[model samples]
Target: MNSPEQVPQDDDAEVVEPARPRRKGIYALPNAVTLAALFAGFYAIVMAMNGRFEHAAVAVFCAMVLDSLDGRVARMTNTQSAFGEQMDSLSDMVSFGAAPALIVYEWALKGQGKWGLIPAFVYCACAALRLARFNTNIGVVDKRYFQGLPSPAAAALVTGFIWVMDDAGFKNVSTMPGMPWVAAAVALYAGLTMVTNVPFYSFKDVSFKKTVPFIVIVAIALLIALINLHVPGMLFGLFCVYGVSGYVVYFMRKAKGKPVSVIATSTDEPDERGLH
Candidate 1:
């Protein structure tokens, strides 16, 4: 605290303390985007409850897109704030964590009775754990590779399966032979993957502002066309590949006898544990 000082104006003034300025309030734009993402996640859950699984899946995917944009927009606009960051994390939990778990459970797991709830709860819990770990280890972890499957990607993996099956005219997961079993496996896999030590590509090194060759643009165009051909199947397949890519990295590292940890340094996170 600042010590009170006396003014010597007329030798008759009492001492007074200086007033401190108030801290700034939260930013508007980034937080607005974060709230929109949160709303999308909430909408997905609500839709799932109403038996609109396809819409729910779409809503979760929408949340993922919006979640990705909020951070970039905040950074680009110079509006990044602690409030925005926290809001983003919370939004992600709802969007990529809880929403996917609930939606998938409603679509498939609910059919398996109590057994179905196990993977959903595990996934939800793992997502929470993963997000907490991410927040605490922001500067201590590797940037090019995520320590585990990202929550958004995990959410995408589950939601994409729902979208693909729903689009294929499968009215329910249990009706399809082995679909419920497959979905349960996906849930457990995605959930467990979130808390694993396996390295998944972060794509952080891919800079948007950097110049690229002409073929890169053409390739992107072609990619868009391919996706347009079959949105659900293509998206699900992409996320499935990404979902398992972490294991591929882990096995590759193991085969080479390299230290497979994703944390920046051994001392940085001595307690770091992941599935090898």
Candidate 2:
């Protein structure tokens, strides 16, 4: 046997460090909400396929509502995560981007051959581009304004049109004179607007934590009553106004000689070119 102090350890014996406990599965609540939103989008697509355009529209709208809640829920619950952010983005692409495009096409654009397909494709593509840009520029963007029309709002505009028209008995109006063009116009407007630099108010600075006047609560009740009075028409009309509000703000800022870009101006990091 070797001397005790100089004894050679068995070369084959291995030291095994204790394995770290796998991190607990990602925070479930927010991601579950995201999954629910994604399911709404999927349901919308399925409803469109089944010729239930009205139901499809409603599902898309539901997705929009859920999508809006996920981020706020995550923030409020202190469970924000990179995974949740990405999950939200993917869910949005399906709900707002793909679902709306496909639903519009099935509801109106299907009969126009390439004319209809082109605008639907444009809208979907622009949605993807807009989301990508938003992700990349998140750090440099103004929190008070979105650099482009938000995907949820865009989905709302597209699906809202379908809902109002369907409610008005315009179901499958692909053969109705000028209707396809009208659908195409709405699709093109919502789609192209997403890629524009026009800044839409984000409403992020509206803190729910602050105390508000009694009138605000009363006004909210009135607004709820107004919506309940004529759900489809009122919702569509509201979103329609919002769709053009960005242009109004952009032109107003331009005419007043104010910077129209929503990107933060910085000399120290001056490399964010073409964002405007």
Candidate 3:
């Protein structure tokens, strides 16, 4: 018999195992921003339904800002993941795709009935297609330009139209009898731009780090301030110009026997103007 002190302990039968690692949380800062953007999109839809068109349009813009930041934040923090990409895409479809389409339809297209709804659906469907193509081709395409017009840009064009008209005091513009056809045409153009093969400037290659004159910086700052002050009108005009410019650029390129590319059409470009 063994003494009590020398008694065999149960330790011989027990095996110690390494501790399991803690599971990581999904609520990272960047992802939080993405979620916020998604919320903003949902809110935009709600606001639009409430007849607060301006607020709804602004919410979509806020969503765009948050969406742009989330990716950069993730990249900066080295937290980029497949999950983030998918979430971002889903958020975009809501904010830039569905939200904008619905807002435009409710704010202006409702009066046109089927004529208006068709274009709204077309824009939304095109935006979805554009996003899907962007995801698949992001790495394969040229880093300097987009393959087609971005969905956000198209959305901006539609939303901006409303903002500008509102600002211009065109309260009954949407119901002005003949205006529905014009809205349909605009929507169709925006929708087609997303699927077109037009090459738009990605501005991805431009670097602000290059040495430049102080006056250039001042000029740029002033330009930005002006844009900030006149956001709705300027944004509307900018996108309108962007949409029309594509045709001009294409024709110019054709005349010169050079390949024409649309500006900011692809993810290959950097978000220079904060339009991304």
Candidate 4:
């Protein structure tokens, strides 16, 4: 019904208007990996319930691997988003938090009855709190160090302990020789570490830009290969050492009235690299 001039003007306006942005889908590549990791955590719970403890432990380990990759993958693909971060935290809570607690409890703590369940819940609750705090404080906290023990590290400690014990044929020890108390002790330690204020190295800021001796890289590579060869045993031992190392550093810091810097410090005052 419009005149030709009016019709052309309307058409031109429609053409010139910016197109609305398309809504993104949930099926992003990195998100797919994150979901896969979540599935692995769920699968671990199922396997643990079926009395397949070793398989369940292995699944948790796989989840850890996938969890580690998801972020790096997202960054590489330029798919980093608030949604991905939130989803990753939720997945981590399930994989490194609830699943590990349930797996360890069923494997060794069930025999302890109510006593065993307490520590399991403690670890799980602590992990949840840790994740929540991490999510809330992400950019505010120093990226170079974690304020508390990372959930993955806590999960590794628990899973590795189970793996080493199982491999060494100590299945019955968990029920005897005051092992329930030992399990409780381990759980307590893990939970406390999660909520503690101790600064642990994040390794997030480490980069190749820093000059390093060639021999150092070779030594690290060989050490990692050696550990991989032994697998669960060596891995368990290393995690145990890492857990204890925090306390040792804490004590040293207390003695000195200040935290010791693990990284190199320049002679110039007001070191930028040092944790303030």
Identify the leading candidate in terms of lDDT: 2
Candidate 3 Cα outliers beyond 4 Å, as residue runs: 1-27, 260-276
TM-score of each: 0.87, 0.87, 0.81, 0.83
Displacement of residue 210 (Cα, Å) in model 2 is 0.8
- Better structure of 1 and 4 per lDDT: 1
Question: In model 1, which range of ten residues has the least summed lDDT?
Answer: 267-276
Clashes of 2: 0
Across 105-181, the per-residue lDDT of candidate 2 in tens digits comes to 99899999888899899999999999999999988877778888998889889889999989988765988889888
| All-Cα superposition RMSD per candidate | 5.6, 6.3, 7.7, 6.0
Error of 2 at 208 (Å): 1.0
Which of the predicted structures, 1 or 4, would earn the higher TM-score when compared with the native? 1
Q: What is the per-residue lDDT of model 4 for residues 1-276, given as tens digits with 9 covering 90 to 100?
A: 865574335544545578887565453888989999999999989998887777787888899899989999988877787788889999999998999899888887889778788999999999999999887766556667776888888888887877777777776555676776776788778878988877787778778579999999999999899898878888878778877776777777889798553332433432246555
- Tell me how far candidate 4 lies from the true structure as C-alpha RMSD in angstroms: 6.0
Model 1 spans > 4 angstroms off:
1-22, 175-177, 266-276
Task: Show model 4 residue runs off by greater than 4 Å.
Answer: 1-27, 172-174, 208-212, 259-272
All candidates in order of TM-score, best leading: 2, 1, 4, 3
